[model samples]
Target: MTMSAVVMRKGGLELIETPIPRPGPGDVLVKTLANGICGSDLHAVTHGAELVDGFRAVTGADPFDLNGQVVLGHEFCAEVVENGPGTRGTHAPGTRVVSAPFLLREPQPVLLGFGGVDTPGGYADYMLLSEDLLIPVPDEVPTDTAALTEPLAVALHAVNRGSLGSDDVPVVIGCGPIGLAVIAVLRMRGIGPIIAADFSPARRAMAATLGADIVVDPRETSPYDSWRSVAAVSDPARFGRQTVSFPGFGFRPSVVFECVGVPGVIQQILGGAAPCTKVVVAGLCMEQDTFYPTFGVLKEIDLVFSISYTLEEFGQAIGHLAAGELRVDPLITSRIGLAEVPDAFARLADPEQDAKIIITPNAR
Candidate 1:
């Protein structure tokens, strides 16, 4: 049987009918329920080869082959349809679930939807998932909300890598989905006096709605300096100076999250950071970026890089949504069907248009 899918060809995304992918051993067939358009998906469609090369450079294996059609959807929710051979029926048919977006394999794990000609993602009517990585969704959580497990897990992992202290203030540099997700996770952890910055007023509003104490537009006020309002420093001007900690005075160092993965953002954050602050890099900047090492060295700033989420973090994300601990419903700004996937991609190029867009493959 053939299924409709939005494939990333050499040119761009095209809706076409292709045979429904059969699940391999230790895999299960899943009917797409809901999928979120990720920034990575946007990069993958346009810079397929560059992404592949970067993936190869980082992980030493290229999962996406530009030579063939690629279906791209990583953040998604699906319903179990059938179990493949050599697989135990852990989740029965009709059960709603989400996976890690990786198809466990022999040589290496294949990135589903981005595995080129073989594995398709949630952009289609059906796809394959590893039973080992499947997490059952609770009945109360909306499918769209459950679909966010992947990205939320990403935020959770980034937060984990941060190793935040109770007194450390967090400053999220971008209010995009990842940055907003970081803010949500920080709020969920009860890490307060959260400061978020973005150029777009709409996104800054979203950041505040997600529990950011202070949201600023970098153009007007600097995010690094926004912390001074909440910090109980004896001398506000001395807070971010290049000297050692003043234990007598209440000084909270900033944990700046570079969510805007552009070239100059790191340098900008480094320049604005306080002494001994930790800067967590969560944004997936695909291009070659440059930053001065001296800026970080002079401030004694700890630069940390974060990537995909762990399985435990993924499960935690599901639990957070199921328990309503993190109210992420606001993160989803729009919902579209498979037919509108191509158009939605274009709209997402403008950051102010929407934060997260969910794709309902079978929506009527």
Candidate 2:
């Protein structure tokens, strides 16, 4: 049987016809209805080798090797249409569900996002997966809406590490989807006065809509520029520009979440945080260098790295998003069908798009 898919060819993407993949033992055949184009996909397409799932590095491997038509999406919310032999009977047809993205096995573990480095991705009509990873999407949640669970999982994980409570002042240093989710999650927990920093005014504004107390554009108020002299580097473009053009805002946040994944920003956050303050590197700063342990030791500050989410964690994320505690639907600025995947990726990669963009694979 033929299936429609967004296939990645040499330096470009094309919707091509491919055979539907049958689920293997311990696997379920998921009919992908919605997929989110993650920043990692952009990094891979541009860098030719982005970190798969943020954990392992895959280089010139089978799926990512020179000439393979690798799938390009990581965050997918789909439904189960069929099950393979010996699969658990727990899953049923037409179940509203969001999966863990990858399957695992004994002896060899399945890393949710990165393990797909060698396996076909879920950006197609049918994604094969071992039963252990898939979970019910939940009632009252449409696939387009729940597709956000994956990124939300990430945001929740970061928040969990930040140790943010209703009383803490939280600051997120990036307005990407995950960054925005961080702000929303904090708000849902009754955490107020959250500050969102970004170069994009659109993103900053979106943060405001989501519940950010203040939007700081480092382009104008670079986080490093002493707040006393924050106006020196003040520039509107710093907050929403394509690059980190601003000096930075003040350093009063007891808990800092770095989501931009830029080395300089990470450095700025690390050096500027108050002694004993905690810094959660939410965004992957690939170029970040190790700081002198003495700084952390002397300041009594803590640095934690948050990658993916666990089962319970992912569930908590969906609960908040579904319960309306975390208002995220408004952040979904655009939705397009399969044919628009390429363009969607382009716009998402571009700095102009406003809020989180969701790809409705079957929107057409």
Tens-place lDDT digits, model 1, residues 279-336: 9999888889888898888668899999898888899999999999989999999999
TM-score of each: 0.95, 0.82
Candidate 1 backbone collisions, by pair? 113-121
Q: Taking the tens digit of each residue's C-alpha lDDT, what string does model 2 give over 1-364?
A: 8677776655577787678876667877777777777777666666544343232443333335425576777678877888888887678988767776666556664533332223446567777777777778767776777888888889898989987644456667898888888888888888756767888878888888888877888878754333223212244442211212222432233678888887576567767655556789888654536666666666666789897888789878778767767668876778777788778777886555845666665555
Instruction: In angstroms, give how far residue 94 of model 1 lies from its true place.
Output: 0.7
**lDDT per model, in order?**
0.88, 0.69
